[model samples]
Target: MQAPVQRQCSHVSTCELFPKFGLRGSLRVWQVFYCLGNFEGCARYRLSCEGRAVPASLLPNGRELNIDALVGKP
Candidate 1:
């Protein structure tokens, strides 16, 4: 018999991809992977239209939030 798999979120409540806006607003890690299409593909995801790297956050328009100003020069 095959062993059962234990699926869990790697970055739940840690990563900045999802903000904690009440109970219904935040997203789980699985949701991030679902929207991203692949687990290993987030680094390549666009941080900004002007080409910049920033912390992860999703917008109401279904776009990645670019908070370079908030993070401020790594």
Candidate 2:
């Protein structure tokens, strides 16, 4: 028997937010839930498909992240 194939977001390699998901343990859920799981539900993926610009701070859930605040930047 063959193992089931895993479905991942095609934009994972080009998505700016992809690399940031690994920096913190709490952020891993995004990768598991969106990047690897239900990518169709991801806001970034949706925007990309529509030919819209995806902000670097945009989360998969359609929430904008204040990256500077999280990273302690001015």
Per-residue C-alpha lDDT of model 2 across residues 1-74, encoded as one tens digit per residue: 99988899999999988878887778889999999999999999999999999999999999999987656579
Candidate 1 lDDT score at position 39: 31
Give lDDT tens digits, candidate 1, residues 1-74: 99865443343354364343222334444344533344333442334433665445554234555455334436
Give residue 26's error in model 2 in angstroms.
1.2
Top lDDT: which candidate number? 2
Per-residue lDDT, model 2, residue 34, is 98
Cα deviation in Å at residue 10, candidate 2? Answer: 0.3
TM-score of each: 0.29, 0.88
**lDDT (Cα) of model 1:** 0.42
The pairs that clash in candidate 1 are: none
TM-score of 2: 0.88
